[model samples]
Target: MNEQTKKQYTMAVLNLLQPKIASLVKEAHPVYQEDLEQELKLKMLEKMQTPFLHNIPSFFEFVSSNEKK
Candidate 1:
């Protein structure tokens, strides 16, 4: 992805994770809390770069895939 798209994607994911990250850092030592939050955000952004799926499955497609166990 281009730089602009990549940055936007990172920001969106980080925004979604902000609350969870805050909670996670809350229990950390006061001196380490900021560092812990930064590390968590960095890790999440790194993982998001990995490919997940190119497209979402439609209802019929999902049904067919799940049929016959």
Candidate 2:
């Protein structure tokens, strides 16, 4: 897909998945649930702002590089 479409799809998937993830996290930890959700939302927004087109590496490459770091 084109860059715009890719970004939109990425966001759509994140939107769909985030609530389920947040729910699970909240269920696991009853305290500070709202804070966790807010923190996760902010982090997601920060990650989404970084374009994934030019600098994104393969999954294995990313994992290995992070391991090295």
Candidate 3:
């Protein structure tokens, strides 16, 4: 992808993660929230960059399932 498209894709993923990120922050201890948030962002970006798509879950779906636990 071009630089602009890559950035747009990243931002789109980030936007989709906002609500889940907020939920995770509230669910986590305040002291660890920043670290957890950063980790989640890294994970989301990593998942986005991967080319394979055989059994991968949608980002929000994964977040929702995690939220349930």
Q: Which candidate is the best by TM-score?
A: 3
Query: Worst 10-residue stretch by lDDT in candidate 3?
Result: 47-56
lDDT at position 3, candidate 2: 87
Candidate 3 lDDT over 1-69, as tens digits, reads 598988897898799879989897889999999999989999888887777843578899999999999
Candidate closer to the true structure by TM-score (higher is better), 1 or 3? 3
Tens digit per residue, CA lDDT, model 2, 1-69: 598997797679678978686776767567778777777777776776676754789899999999998
- Which segments of candidate 1 are over 4 A away from where they belong? 52-69
Instruction: In model 2, state the lDDT of residue 42.
Output: 72
> Which should have the higher TM-score, number 2 or number 3?
3
What range of 10 consecutive residues in model 2 has the weakest lDDT sum?
45-54
The digit string of per-residue lDDT tens for model 1 on 1-69 reads 588987897898799889989999999999999899989988887777667632567889989989946
Candidate 2's error at 59, in angstroms? Answer: 17
lDDT score of residue 38 within candidate 2:
71
How many residue pairs collide in each prediction?
0, 0, 0
Q: Which stretches of candidate 3 lie over 4 Å from their true place?
A: 53-69
Q: Residue 66 deviation, candidate 3, in Å?
A: 34
